[model samples]
Target: FDLVELHRSNRATPPGIVLDPFAERALSPADRGGDRREPPDETSGATASRGGSGARHDRLVALDCSWETAERLVEDFAGVHRSLPFLVAGNPVSYGTPFRLNTVEAFAGALCILGERDSAERLLSKFTWGHTFLELNEEPLARYADCADSTEVLAVQDDYLAEE
Candidate 1:
């Protein structure tokens, strides 16, 4: 289900003992289509889960401090979305791109989180370090900022993922 649907059903509260506001906010109706929109009505399809229950939403969330955590999230997502096609792309641990899977083993083969247009924007929004961290990679930032389109920006994971 989408954000609007979640709030409508009042099932916006996802599973688990705790809730990450970012994740919760992700399901909020206003956040569904983009950063625009004024929330949703009470009975929109966007709020209905595939199961007609909130269980699928519950399973989507996982908090992990280890690789095991990552694996489980992927497993659950794959299990729930077996029918709907999705592109999984991220680091080397998850499956690489250009491949499809109906199980977690696909993750073992290669984990590739496809940075489609929206996903790419989400990544850039979450990963940027602002002006302070920018000092560490002034040259690259200066070079990349000159580009107009987001796709034109080269993403150097090392600069963002590496521990300072």
Candidate 2:
């Protein structure tokens, strides 16, 4: 929760502050496979989802940067990496779009997926369009939060993708 790391380097992509291989690289269940949603490999169970226990730790990290840089800096980060399931973006720039959330929205969506709806709402309260995000993603967010793990989350996501 506290700001633990902030490296001010002369280089453009400094260490610690920016991150995310997961958020940028993650594809929807349907996107990962053709028509059928493939489950993650056996080795990925722990990192797949934070569903069952909810609070793995008090801290939640949200990475903000270009996709180009994110891919490069991904290995620099360390933690339980989990991707948010598909949710509609409510930010003005990418409104109604999927997988285009800004940093705050991404943070909120992660919080929602982690089963902390009230905390997520509080975090989103700072922005005007934030409420709209919750409104747009309410159903999926709730379903995702209730999932037992990534497999269940993927099943729920496949249902949404089927509607599109």
Please list the Cα RMSD from the true structure of every candidate, rounded to 1 decimal place.
14.7, 8.9
TM-score for each of the candidates: 0.21, 0.67
lDDT of residue 25 for candidate 1? 19
Query: Candidate 1: which stretches are off by over 4 Å?
Result: 1-62, 69-116, 128-164
Writing each residue's lDDT as its tens digit, candidate 2 over 56-156 gives 23344444555566555544444334566788889898899887777677767766776667767886887889899999999988877777666788788
Show the colliding residue pairs in model 2. none
Candidate 2 has what TM-score?
0.67
Clashes of 2: 0
- Segments in model 2 whose C-alpha atoms lie over 4 Å from true places: 1-56
